[model samples]
Target: MRSQLRPETRIDRCFEALKREGRPAFVTFVTAGDPDYETSKAILLGLPEAGADVIEIGMPFSDPMADGPAVQASSLRALKAGQTMKRTLQLVREFRAKDNLTPIVLMGYYNPIYVYPSEAFLDEARDAGIDGMIIVDVPPEADEELCLPAIQRGLSFIRLATPTTDDKRLPAVLANTSGFVYYVSITGITGAAAPVVSDVRAQVARIKRSTPLPVVVGFGVRTPEQARVIADCADGVVVGSALVETIRTTLGTDGRAGPDTVSAVHRIVHNLAAGLRGAAARV
Candidate 1:
């Protein structure tokens, strides 16, 4: 239904192709300019080849309240390396020059976009080959300010449904939500701990009964086995903090990204993709 009216975007195309393939998508996330731009770009360009169906490019902000320690540190590293809203979008632009098929979603806080002029930012993002967004601080109540405008420009405004989103509040959360709904399986911040498989399965079932949009479970998923379990229960599985932690491990003594930074992330994504692929085959 959301796809019928909006311009055909890479996000929609990617999900549709997965439906035909009878497999769940493996979504990946990384901070732009973490340590430096070139290294982050290498990770970005390498993800899809490593089997990432959708990539969430985080825009580095000075104050990230919703992020966990790992993600917060990554944001600080990116900002220290000069990652701005302009630079983040520019990274997507550079990525689009070579690969235009995999969907890229901008995920972060709202302050940067609001400071950049909402309409102007949307125009530039639409031109930059961005497919969707997940602004954590901006809720459905503020749709007029950013959400609606983004949808009008054909950008999918992905909403987050957490463990606290009850049946009463679920409708409001799903109302303006486009693309796919991100179901945070855990209650706390990112990189905390793995969620119970049965609880997440029940929540995914509940959300699916309410909305036609795909329900992707994320947060606290740190292993290939965990990804496979979540993929079996939900429409997709998103792995972020664990992946960012890998980047952290690859940093040198000076905190600069080492030569193996990109390769480290590639291995994680490769194993996760293989896990989901195997799960899909079993189904």
Candidate 2:
């Protein structure tokens, strides 16, 4: 008998499509409304064309403690430019108006969503075409707070598994994780250090044995070469801080986005996508 068909989401189809192409996905992260709205909109619209398979839009927050310096600065810039949780959803709505295929995942802490009152935000998110979530603060123990509710609403609640996620804890992390598992290559804050390939590979392998979800490694992945190395082992690779830093450095003297800001981020995504492609060709 044929196996039962599983539900397919934009994120699910994205990984499946990349699997057929024999390549790891290149995921891009951008803080919505960083510096300003129009500039951030340009970056979001250009990402897919620039070779991003999936996009993670960060909800600008004040105390982004888990984020490293680069990402924290991005949040501040967005907040300074008047980016609100409501505006963040509008960014996704605007993005959905152009591209219907590339999956968009909202990555952020839980406070903003809690303030939005879980149900209302989830309904708005679904309407805005968000495919998944990467809430760093919500653990399996507290899945009822967000994860379970998100899943019930047909949204993939992607979970993060770190090198410190031992075997005993792996099951809890994977218990309700959907879309794909974001394997943080480092234990500390995001982008603090580079990830060793061997260590990442071993951890990815261990996580896979616990769940069938595609493991995508992130954190400390900055350059295209580093992306290629991580892509060689995992199902996908994520680059955030480096891309955020590009926006941070490219801002004008007055602290607004520069003329080349959008193009600069597109270039970063393009090169990383190329790296993943090159790695896939090798495989």
Candidate 3:
């Protein structure tokens, strides 16, 4: 079945450019307002220059069930620092002012969007320069609530295809999915274990047979070596827990962003991007 068409977003363009360069995209994830707004913004502004091809800014939520400890803690820190839906959008708006080409995807659960009142949230998100969204809680079954509306408004509604997403369930998952298909390399929560390269290669092939959208693998991907191997088989690689952990470790004793917090995260991103560059693109 042919997938529905949506507006050509920054995400599509980013992947097109990466394909021409013969390398997988280095997608980074950081919590919006993590530690604090200023620190988060500084980190956001530097990502493109540090070699991130696509950026996934996590929206701080009280209960991010899909995430592991590192991302959960990042959310708590952001929320403690007064991160809100509006502030998250403001972060994107501010990032857009400096860099316009890198695609930005807001990733998190749906409660915040629901509370921001759905339609209004989509409008503001687009205006704020968000290219797509990864709402873990909203399934393909409930596309009417948010997915359809978001696509209609020009936001790519990215979907996740897990290890368990068998052939039977794969089509529905890809139906409304746009921008790309995020293949969760592991079966469990984020950052739980290392992804088997062979397993990832097989799963990515399976997903590719179903759709033409770029398939990026994530979960349990931490080091540059791991990123390189994963990127070899997928269109892109997403590093969330690893990046969030970098921020956590760089925080001052007072649990705030120290001087090195921003630079440390950017450095890690640079190394990861270098890994992607070194990878042999999948045939």
Candidate 4:
């Protein structure tokens, strides 16, 4: 467990605490049951060891609109194979038995949560050793009902902002954003390429001007150089599609993350970790 004694601190506090200690956090995202439960567990546990400072465990749902083809495909694969919210929480419990301290954040759409009762979902998440929840589709207008309770439960409720979000609306999003505000680097879905680097930097700057919360840039970041570039403007960079794509290619037509999959992800994370460290040095 973290020794700083802010168990109730929002997700941003966790990242801020780490930043004060002079280390950039590595956040990795993976579907709960793309390959299977055991594989999901492996990815979760392996992440911290593989240089991930935080783990974003994806709760698979049928309609993941925020996700691009890579993540959408992964979600479909997991759903087709029968992954549910309950099973995902169970995986968190299993992960906690061995590794107790690393922060685990659940990322997914709101449909699954809507299917289950909200308070019940929060209770289960707390019991499962989850530190936070990222319901991608939940808007700030619904914060009174959703984000507030999550904060009260001592679980961080992270929010997302896209390129289209305006100045007046950005603060509202930041106000409800607990962990770190997930600033989508581009205007489109998760895997689409960011056409201009300057635009992303400007967006990060705009968000930073309005809030003190640490901003983590994500979506369409596919390489170490890209991660490094994005990190220059934000506190953290999140890469999803690229990593998931690695998993897909490693698996043959018959769903399996072969030997190459693990090795590829390991290498990619290792390099990204190094790049983030380098970025931290510049700051």
Against the hidden true structure, what lDDT does model 2 obtain?
A: 0.91
3 versus 4: better TM-score goes to: 3
Candidate 2: residue pairs that collide: none
In candidate 2, what are the lDDT values of residues 14-64, reduced to their tens digit? 999999999999999989999789999999999999999999999988999
Per-model TM-score versus the true fold = 0.97, 0.97, 0.97, 0.91
Per-residue lDDT for 169 in model 4? 81
* Local accuracy by lDDT, each model: 0.92, 0.91, 0.92, 0.79
lDDT, candidate 1, equals: 0.92
Model 1 residue 51 lDDT score: 91
Model 3, 1-283: lDDT tens digits are 3344455789998999888888898889999999899999999999999999999999999999998999999999999999999999988998899888889999999998998899999999999999899999999999999999998888999999999999999989999899999999999999899999999999999999989999999999999899998988889899999999999999989998989999999999999888778885343
Measured with C-alpha atoms, the lDDT of residue 28 in candidate 3 is 92
> Cα RMSD (Å) per model?
1.0, 1.8, 1.4, 3.1
**Lowest lDDT 10-residue stretch of candidate 2:** 1-10
- Residue-level lDDT of model 4, residues 1-283, one tens digit each, is 2223335543555586777867656778888886677666777677777777778888998888878899999888778777888999899999999988788889997777877878899899998889888888788899877778887788888888888899878867887666677888777888897636798889888988877667888888887787777887778778778778878888867786676766777777888888888877777
State in Å the error of residue 218, model 4. 0.4
| Candidate 4 or 1, higher TM-score | 1
